[model samples]
Target: MQGAWFAFILTLLAGLSTGIGSLIAFFARRTNKTLLAVSLGFSAGVMIYISLVDMLAEARLDLLGQYGQPGEWLALGAFFAGIGLTALVDLLVPEVENPHHAWRVEEMESAAEAARARKLLRTGMVTAMVLALHNFPEGIATFVAGLMEPATGVAIAMAIAIHNIPEGISVSVPIFYATGSRRKALLYSCLSGLCEPLGAAAGYVFLLRFVSPGIFGVVFAMVAGTMIFIAFDELLPAAHEHGEHHHAIGGLIGGMAVMAVGLALVR
Candidate 1:
């Protein structure tokens, strides 16, 4: 019971980090493009590094132990399946209202801006919905990882939290601009974040009963794939779009270095 509660709290904290982004949108004088870029890059680096080195390796070990060589292919297949699912979500969402879009707070501060903000509102809402959906599996992944290994869970939560900061910023700025309601903006951001805990709860209640080392390993591989895809498809591009190439690259390296060190220390 304590372990489950701990997982819930960690997942909840990660989800609520979006509120941090909401606060940033409301208070910051200007969007720190360089910081955002480097941060996103760093998020990507950490995610990619973990997927390739830590989580994937864990998955391979467990699968090989359980089902011999065939389990190896199964784990690898699960990783690709994750990428396909994310890609399908991207395809289902409309291009104009794509969830990956980011906007600045200043752009939405004027009455004259309402027209532009209206368009952005659709994008923000759509992004929120998409993010909520994306976060569901992530919540489960985090919960399960935490249940299995607290240290890995903490690391995963940190990486997810870092990227979610930008997501919160993306969700809040436009909606606030469009409706001129901080309450509404914060509500939406918080709601989207709530999905993480909801996902964790659901996954625990329904999925935990069936978990085995093999199953856990497979899910870990898939989640690793999901993070890698998110980093490449969303974080990197967004970072480059918002900030300079050099800053983004530097952040990416820094993030990888940090994650590597964290894993090493845990080991």
Candidate 2:
């Protein structure tokens, strides 16, 4: 029970990282491209390492124990399925609008709104909703992984949290700029993270009943795939776009290396 509570908290913390970014947006006044690049790179490394070394391997082992050779194939399929599913979600969501080129937040403006400001506020709220849906399942994955293994869960949580910082920026920048309300924009960003704890709660109420080693393994594999896709498809590209950093590839390698060490230490 204590472990479960801890896992839930970790998942919540991971999801709420967007709030951190949102806060940064409100005060920082500039993008800090180098910081964003390095953080994103580091996040990618952490995710890749955990996915390959820890999650995927555990998944394969579980599949082997259950269906033997077929289990391995099943795990692989599930892995890709997770990636495809997330990509599909991204494709379906409508894009948010940002007038300012700056990716980070600058300062808060008064909440007075014209017609255009209202539209921007609506966009920000909608984007936050979309992000909440996306984050829900991720929260579940993080919580479950943590419940099963605290160390592994911590690594995953950190990776997810780091990745989420940029997402916070993505959410807050437009709304703040449009409506000139730091509080409103930051609220939307923070709300997006709530999905994680919601996901965890749902899993606890329903899926925990049927929990087994095999189930855990398959889920882990899927989570691994999900994280990898997120890292490659989103984090790496965003990092590069945010900063003209020379160490883009280096950041990737560094992320992977850090994750590997993290996994090793946990084991």
Candidate 3:
């Protein structure tokens, strides 16, 4: 139980990366496109590798114990179900306030001059909500992984933390622009990421009964599918929008290499 609490704290640390994003937004004069592209790509790589290699295999191990060959198929089905669930949410929720949207220099300056305060505040708040929704499953993943393995938990948490930075930017930038209150924007952004920890706590409380290797594998596959979708649908497009495809690809490879090494060491 004490270990679980400790692991849980690590998960919280991983998910609170919105705070990092908020701080960066408060300090940065402009978005660092190269950095963003690389980091986002790197996150995608970590998630993909871990989900496929470690998580899915764990799930198979657990499910095979209970259901044999049928269990393997069920795990795959559940994996698809997880992907479908996230995709459905993404589809149902209109992306009216995507954080990845870049502003042209002149457009930004003009908006600065022309926009009212309320609009920016509203935008920030909405960004928070969108990000919170996006981050819920990540919290679950971190909590579950941490509970299962401490070192792997740290790696998963780090990956999630790296991924949360952009989301923080998503929440802070608009709020700062809208209200010109750096503090408020940062606060909101940080709060938005807190949802992840909350998700972790809730998932931990409710999901222990289902925590078998097969279930883990299916969930991992589902998460992998969701991440791949986000990489292509969100991260890659955003990276390209910043005009740094090579950097993003390089980051992707680096992320994969690091995770590969971590897995090898753990095994």
Candidate 4:
């Protein structure tokens, strides 16, 4: 019960971190492109390294224990399935409104064109909705990681939280521009983040009745795949878009190093 509570709390904090981004968008005078770029790259590095080194290995072990040699293939299939699921979600969201499409604080100025206000509002709303959809699986991934290993969960949650900041900015910029209301922009940004916790709750309720080693293994692998997809498809590109290539790469290496050290200490 305590562990479950802890896991839920972690998920909640991660989800709410989006609000931090919204706040940053509202208050920051200038867009810190280099910092944003490095941060995004760092997040990507953490997710990619942890997903491959820790989550995948853990999943393989659990599956092997449950199903012998065939478990290897099963883990592989599930990993790809996770990637496929996220990809499908991405495909469903129009490219224009996809939350992964990068936005910065500077854009807020340009977004305020009076003629485009209505269009901007619609874009913000659609982005919020799309972001909610994307966050659902991420919520599940974080919750499951918490249940399996608290330390890993913390790492995953932090990485997710970092990535989500940009998402909040993405949702808020257009909305604030359209509505001329910081409150509305912030509200919508936070609402989109709420989906993360909602997803965690939903996934937990459903999985509880069917909990087993095989199920755990499959889910872990899928989560790993999802992380990998986000890292490569979203985080890296967005990082590069925000700043210099070398900055992004440096941050990536720094992130991996930090995670590696943490893992070593914990082990």
Candidate 5:
């Protein structure tokens, strides 16, 4: 019960970190492009390294123990299935309104044009909806990982939280500018973030009766696939868009190194 509670709390905290981004959007004078770039890159690195080194490996081991050599194929299939699911979600959302499309805090300055306000509001609402969809799988990933290993859960939650900061900015900026209401912007941002915990709760309810080694193996592999897709497709590109290539690369390497050290110590 304690472990379950811990995992739920971690998921809740990760989801709510979007509110931090909302607050930053309101207070920061300018988008710190370089910092954003590096941070996003760092998050990508952490996710990629952990997904491959830890989650995938663990999943393979679990599956192999259960099904012998055929388990290798199963693990691979589950991993790709995770990617396919995320890709399907992406295809459903129009590219223009995809929350993964990075938004800068500086956009707030120009968003006051009355002609564009309605469009911006629609964009914000769409982005929020899209982000909620993206966060659902993440909530499942985080919750399952936390249930399996608290340390890994903490790392995954932190990575997801870091990336979500920008998502909060993405949803809030356009809405705040469109509605001229901080409260509305914050409310929408919080609502979008709430999906993470909602997802966790939903996954828990559905999977509780069937929890088993095979289930863990499948979920871990899927989680690895999902995180890898996010890192490569979203985080890396967004980081490059900030125009700090070297810094982004440095942050990536730094993030991997930090995760490596942390894992070594924990093990």
Candidate 6:
């Protein structure tokens, strides 16, 4: 029960970071692209390390116990299925309006807003909706993984929180520009984040009842795959794009090293 509550709080905090990003976008005079880049890179490293070393390792072991000979293939299949699920969601959103793009402060300040108000409004609303949907499965994956293992859950939670900050900016920048209401923009950003905890709560309530060793193993494997995809497909690229040559790489190594220590201490 305590662990469950802890997990929920972790997810909640991660979701709310959208608001933090919104706040940064609205209030901060200067954009710290380099810091954001390093953080994203670090998050990717943490997620990748935990997915492969901890989550997937445990998943494969449980799967093997569940189906001694066939477990390997099943685990592998589930992993890919997770990736496919996330990719499908990505495909559904139009490339021009993908909500995941990190918006820069300079760009926001310099844009010709009066001319583009109508377009920005449409883009903002669509992006918010798409981001909300995208976060649902992530919420489920995070909640379940945490319940399965608290240490790994903490790692995942931290990584997700870091990853979502730019997303918050993505959702808020256009909306604020379109509506000219800081309050409204902040509200939308927060609401989008709320979907994560809501999804987590629903996932836990509905799925916990039916969980078995095999089910747990498969879900964990899927979560691992999803994390890996997010790391490579989203986090790393964004990080590198905004980063100085070595900053993102340095952050990545630091994140992995920190996770290694945590894994060692936990074991």
lDDT of each: 0.80, 0.77, 0.71, 0.89, 0.87, 0.83
Expressed as tens digits, the lDDT of each residue in 159-203 for candidate 3 is 778877777777777777887787887788888888778877886
Consecutive 10-residue window with the lowest summed lDDT within model 2 = 106-115
Q: Return whichever of 1 and 6 wins on TM-score.
A: 6
lDDT of 5 by residue, 133-217 (tens): 8888888878888888899899989999999998999899888988989999999998999899887888788678788768889
Supply candidate 3's per-residue lDDT for 135. 74
Off by over 4 Å in 4: none
lDDT of 5: 0.87
Q: Best TM-score goes to which candidate?
A: 4
Across 142-258, the per-residue lDDT of candidate 6 in tens digits comes to: 887788898888888889988888788878888888889999889998888888888789878866788766998998999899888888888888888887858888878888999
Clashing pairs in 5: none
What TM-score would every model get versus the actual structure? 0.90, 0.87, 0.87, 0.96, 0.95, 0.94
**Which residue pairs collide, candidate 1?**
none
Q: Give the higher-TM-score candidate: 5 or 6.
A: 5
lDDT of 6 at 188: 91
Q: Write the per-residue lDDT of candidate 1 for residues 103-149, one digit (tens) a residue.
A: 45564444225568678688668878977887787787778667767
Error of 4 at 262 (Å): 0.6
Candidate 4, lDDT over the whole model: 0.89
Score candidate 1 by TM-score against the native.
0.90
Order of models, best lDDT first: 4, 5, 6, 1, 2, 3
Q: Looking at candidate 6, what is the lDDT of residue 183?
A: 91
- Residue 35, candidate 1: Cα error in Å is 0.4
